[model samples]
Target: MINKRINITQKNFLLFLYIVILGLFGPVVYWVSNHNTQLPFTGKAEKNPIQKRMSIGEKILVKANNDAAKQEGITAFAGGDYVLAIEKFQSALKRVRNDPETRIYLNNAIAATTESPFRIGVSVPIGGNLNVAQEILRGVAQSQDKINRNGGVGGKLMMVEIANDDNNPEVAQQVAQKFVRDQKILAVVGHNDSNASIAAAPIYQDGGLVMITPTSSAETLTAMGNHIFRATPSTRNLADTLANYAVNVAGSENVAMCVDSDSQVSVSFKENFTWAVYNYGGKIAPFDCDLAAADFSPEEIPSQAISLGADTLLLAPSVRKVKKALEIASDNDDRLTLLGNHSLNTYSTLKDGQNDVSGMVLSVPWYQKAIARNSFIVNAQEFWGGGVNWRTAMAYDATQTVSQAIASGAERQNLQQTLANPEFSTQGATSEISFLPSGDRNLQGGLVKIKPGKKSGTGYDFVPLNMDQIIEAAPKPSPKGATTNPRVKSK
Candidate 1:
């Protein structure tokens, strides 16, 4: 009985050992077969989690390095060390070429280095009451100095060089050619008169240089195919606004225009004024004056207005001329109401006319009183050490616009292409200025009516003109093919 029990126990123990061996070997065989099995779609092994995790970590590290490079580049750029900034940006690009921010800094550095530094070229009139031109240039110089102090466009110093065209079309053309050929300037800021600008347009177009006129308002300029730009509204719009305001708002029935015959800007103003006056149920009588005439008398203008039976007169001339015209108009008829252009909006002009300009109305894009209290304005003034003029503000806006375009990765050659972009809108100082495909600024208008006085309390009170009011009051267009005035060919 003892021998049989020992045999049974040994058999049971063998069975138990066999079961343990199968349990270990079964999983190994199944794993090998499963590893060899092809996936239905990919025919490859499933992705490795360990490898994917390593790749993600590497990507994050690269991103961190790129960010560090970008921050270093901006600091260098802001400090005006464009060379260092360029090197840093190029290194960053090697790691993150697809980054938009990296591309902007690279382009800006290229532009700053490639263009002439500390130099600006202007095509402006040489003589004939150059005070306005002088003031504009002075303002530009001040702005350049300020910008350089703060680390210029890309932290480089800037200088402006003025070129005189003597108000002669041929001279203007020659000067523009010289600016491009000899100077290789990147941009121009003048050729103040519309006639001068038109004459020089072809040269600037060929050179691919940008031009921003502070005063030119010819409608044709708005269509110049080059990178031409202007801060003032077009003459067509100005005339329409003035006439509409005169007849509709001021309640004038009879209007007369005293125009500067020798001035192209004046001729444009007169033609547009006539169309607006007649379209708004008002009559217009025209009087022409030689802008070059030294002994201009208010009596001469009054005689013309009296003959036309005009109760309202529009004077479109430079500030000096406007002041003289106002004096003549007031002397000729105290009952006469004066309507003027943007040239009359300055404190210098208003001060010259003092009580003479009491009731005259003018339109402007911005007013000092309106902006004086704003923090941005205050900061701008403090930055520049005083009140900033319209020209300075325009320059500021232009610089900001250019910087924003660069920041958005716009090519130096195609800066204008980014004018309509939302980034440009966000970068400007005063207003959100975006460009129409036509190269004109999309901006709003403001109106200020002059009241008599010297002190802050009585100098001028401005009423903001709503966009709807401006649109409704705009002058109607003349009938098709009806010429208000003969187109004067540029000399």
Candidate 2:
């Protein structure tokens, strides 16, 4: 009986041990089974809100197109092996020399491996407009490389974190918030579109962070806040430059305007151009066409303009309507003087239009040949393997502005105050940079005309149009209603 009772006691003890073991390990096993794809739930495994939105180190490589060397470099970077990261990034760059993002990563890795670095965030449309994004990034990367090579900002190297906003307003706001949350990021140089910049401006303003936009030029951005600054010339300035040239220099009296009604930038440019044209003793033609119209016919624009007694065609298409603008340019077939805003200053104008766009005058924010700083051009050529456009120039200027402000004071509030100061000024790729009370740059834009040239690599180039060239290209006075009946196919 004693042996039997002992056996029962042992069986009960074994059963209790099994229950305790199951209680402790069952949930873990279940969790492991359910979450096979995820890491174990440690506090370190949890991604922060910033990580969810923005890519960094190895994370960026995953999101972007990747190669073996770049992947290794990013892995090393994520693992805190800065030396390996730098070496691998350099190796990767040797294979793909024209990639701006890899160059930037290499520069950042170099900065990190060498010294303590100050960081800034650059938000761009990496997914939506990869080429444009790279152009902007080339400017930022060039500025960073130059600054680092020249002993950096008081011996602390500058590092940049790239954020892909994809030019979406919602994504831009998210990126802005992420940037504002990170205390290490001193300032931001970013947001390619006016709407994107506008969406993110309020967030940056509320957070007291300095946001310098390289390309956005909407008038609404002018008054967003003291913290928001624009490196590019205001829309009114660009429009006025084009209008003055059209009327006074080009001797155009009657201009037929093609506008994209769906785009704020287009409408704003047209309105400002109209005001400036009327003030300069020129009149807008009565017949106007909307580029954004669903049934808009580019082939008929030229014939209609001729019928309405227009001596010049002003294209105010948005970035989305560039193809339409180019189609109109082809349809015009050199019958009338062509003028466009900065929106049309794209490679498409040179490649797609070719001879069709010759002699077309465009208002641009900066021209490389016209800039006083030859060093910027030389360094850019060496760094990027080619010439860059106004976007690059303006982006470089924006980064220079922030670096100057950071030199005055690295703290966010102090830097904002420094940029807002009336005495603040810095020399940039575009010339001297100074801000008005409205946070708009006190600068004028340049005008360029497309011409056949061997240097452009596209059989055409945008030659800078000086005042003399503008006057020389002016057409002789012709009859107001002179119509050349070009063949038009009705849509």
Candidate 3:
């Protein structure tokens, strides 16, 4: 009985040990069966969830590092350190292969680092006619500041070295000559007046310097060929538009043309005005005045309009001179209707001679009130504060255009090409502008009539002419053998 009891105990102990071993190996056996493999349970297996989360965190850290490197690269490029910028950018690109912003920065850095043989210099008449030129420069400076703050043009800040011309043609020529001889300056912006621009044009062409005039309206400047460019519309275009409006819209068959003989703008105005008027089947009763003549004598101008029975007068004198001429003309005949250029459209006309210019018509390329609410105008105004002049908006547009072209991979030699193929148009305070093939801005010149105010004591009010009506009134030119103006003899 004692032996049998001991055997039972041993059997029970072995069974318990077998159960314990099976419990431990159960999970391992199941895993092995599921994976179609054998199990080795010597070491513990890791939980996959924890390992996967850790891997994800590591990937996020790498992306953050790449973004940081890219930002640093952009900073380096803007600071003019191209070598460091390129390395950092390349490193960042490895991490993020398809970033447009990164690609732009890289392009800019490359352009800056690469040495070019052509060096272009731009000049501005920052002084003289302090109101106009200063306003222009202020706009230019502000625009440049904005561009530099936004990482510059293709990573290179435009360094403009300004020299004052003092509004003197001789001084302008001398300054231009200096820039040409330096070989670093490839272009000039100034000689604000036509006389100054014309004087410096030969020098610029001879020196291979591109002369871009912002204000000169000389007819001869455009004839200088590709070397010269002007941002302002030619007086010729303005004059033609005015003449068409006068003969067709105003219904004036006979017109008296008066021009300041001494002024280049006046010369251009006379030439274009005469051509456009004659082509439109209107007879011109001519009168020319020496703009420098101080006297207000009508004999000095010697108008043939009165003798020829013309009731309408086309006045192409300076704003100040026009006021004098109008005052003189009013005394002679109050019935004479007056027509003028955009120069006469000013606050001074309203302030100085409200009665004299009460019923006159003029053509202008831009109107300030038309674009006063544009965001660019608002931001530019805010940025410039009281320093913003109405004309500065045009300057801002010009500068922005140049910067954008450069940023778009325009080489120095290919500026004209880039300008010709401008991919963008900017809204300025005065006008929305894009360049045409002739470098003339694609803008509409409109007629505005100065009319007496409804209130007896109030100043004259400006009324915009009906553009559609004006277009319809003008005689359609025959496509086949249209009568063309006789070309004026070039001096």
Candidate 4:
């Protein structure tokens, strides 16, 4: 009886061990059998995938049947085949419904068939961190329309590729790579964000592609290479301009700068501005100002400005912080002349805090003059549903610069050379825009003040100020026996 029980136990243990081993290796064996049945296994094939990938050569040669017309169009367009381009664009239009941009491209291509199309790529933050990307895109579209309407570049219709970079650095690099690969594309207008512009600039420089940043204002952006350019003034430029206004226009002997401590642009602006103020013989008031705190009293800057006897309160903070400080300053000091950089010259500023910044001073690259006469600006009211800002104006300028460069017969690699020429100037919306040897636009910018009864979309329109006008307006005695504007001498 004992021997029989021992044999049964041994058999059971062996069976259990076999089941456990099979359980551990079952899935692997089954996968190998099924996957290896179709193709010879070199142990490199992807398992459980829905489709197989083609080799590089095969992928390059193959064209999709679904997008055959679009592919052919792209090929023809890139190869200087305008007749084929027009045909393909028309075919694409018929197949792709609700695609306004495609229709616009087709119409422009049809209208300007004398010469081949000149393609320009545009990268904007369309998905993630879509801060004013739509507005920037509208500016680009307006430029495209105006350029196409004005007989196009070199009598060739302008075609544009609008890509979304999401304002992420990695994504912007991908966008730059795509632009480099497209042979038809000669120039790009994009990267409104400073970081994105900085990230993609190296790729553009290496690819020999011309990249024009519309609103990026980082100090080191143009230092990347000769192929990179910006239409907007840098933070240092804005800082210097603001410093001049603080001392000369606002007549501030002691200027208190309440800057955002966290932002690189703010730090750069503050450093450059401090030196500029010192050079102007103006005193710097030691104010304990912090703009990076998540929660703080709005009265921090105003109280410091008043305590230090600062005649001018220069605000360099986010828009929200600016509005908050504006309210506190306007209520605290009746004689204080609030000053800001280009960031404050916006419709939202007028709409949200007009009364607070009623007598505010701001220096910017574009203002009423550009807004009044440029065809793009004139029609912007109807197309964009409001007045245009500096971003829009600068973006439009960048596109126009590229168009003018191409229209003047600068082709392929010659475009950057022509743009770098000292005599090369393009009629921009704001003024004649030409690049410096360092790829920075040569501009001094302009100053503006908020005035009543001159309303636009937001609240009141900003009237441009001259040094003489501001000086003459200063020294006027107020009803409260206080000087709203202090006396100052202009150079």
What is the C-alpha lDDT profile of model 1 across 1-491, one tens digit per residue? 99999999999999999999889898987887889553322312144221211110112212333577776776787677778877877887677543423543454554466554434555545353344444354444444434554666554445444565555666777667656554335566666677788888777777776676766776777576647776556676667677778887888888776666666677777777776677777787655554447777676776677677878877777543566666665675556788877666555655556676777776554444465466446655554344444544554454444444544655445655565444456434456657656666665444667765434334643333453675676655457424543334452
Model 4, 1-491: lDDT tens digits are: 99999999999999999999999999889998878343422334255121121110111111222266656665665566757867886786577532334444454455446557778877776564333565565666677778787777666777666666766777787678767766778899888667688899998999899999987776778999999998887776677666767776667898777766754455556666776676655777887666766665665556667788887777776433455556555565556677777757766667767677777888777665634466666777655556667777787889889998987888768889989989999887757899888898887677788877455755577778775465454443235422221313120
In order, candidate lDDTs are: 0.59, 0.82, 0.60, 0.68
The TM-score obtained by model 3 is: 0.63
Residue 301 in candidate 2, Cα distance off native in Å? 2.1
Residue pairs in clash, model 1: 80-155, 118-159
lDDT per residue (tens digit) for residues 1-491 in model 2: 99999999999999999999999999999988988354522333135443444544555522454777888988898888989998988888778776777777887887787667889999888877766788888888888888888878888888888888877888898788778878788899988878789999999999888999998887778688989999999888898788879898888999999988876677778877876777667788987699988899999999999889999999988777888999999899889999989987877778888988899999988887754558889888887778888888899999998888877765776788898799999988848999998999998787988889976589999888785465456443334322321213230
Question: What CA RMSD would candidate 2 show?
Answer: 9.0
Worst 10 residues of 4 by lDDT: 53-62
Best by lDDT: 2
Q: What is the lDDT of residue 450 in candidate 3?
A: 78
Task: List RMSD in Å for every model shown.
Answer: 25.3, 9.0, 29.0, 12.1
- Sort order, lDDT high to low: 2, 4, 3, 1
- Candidate ranking under TM-score, highest first, comes to 2, 4, 3, 1
Model 2 residue runs over 4 Å out of place are 1-53, 60-66, 370-373, 468-491
Q: Write the per-residue lDDT of candidate 3 for residues 62-126, one digit (tens) a residue.
A: 22235877877857865778788878877876776533234334544554565552233334443
The C-alpha stretches of model 4 lying farther than 4 A from their native spots are 1-116, 126-131, 294-296, 318-335, 370-377, 381-386, 467-491
Candidate 1 total steric clashes:
2
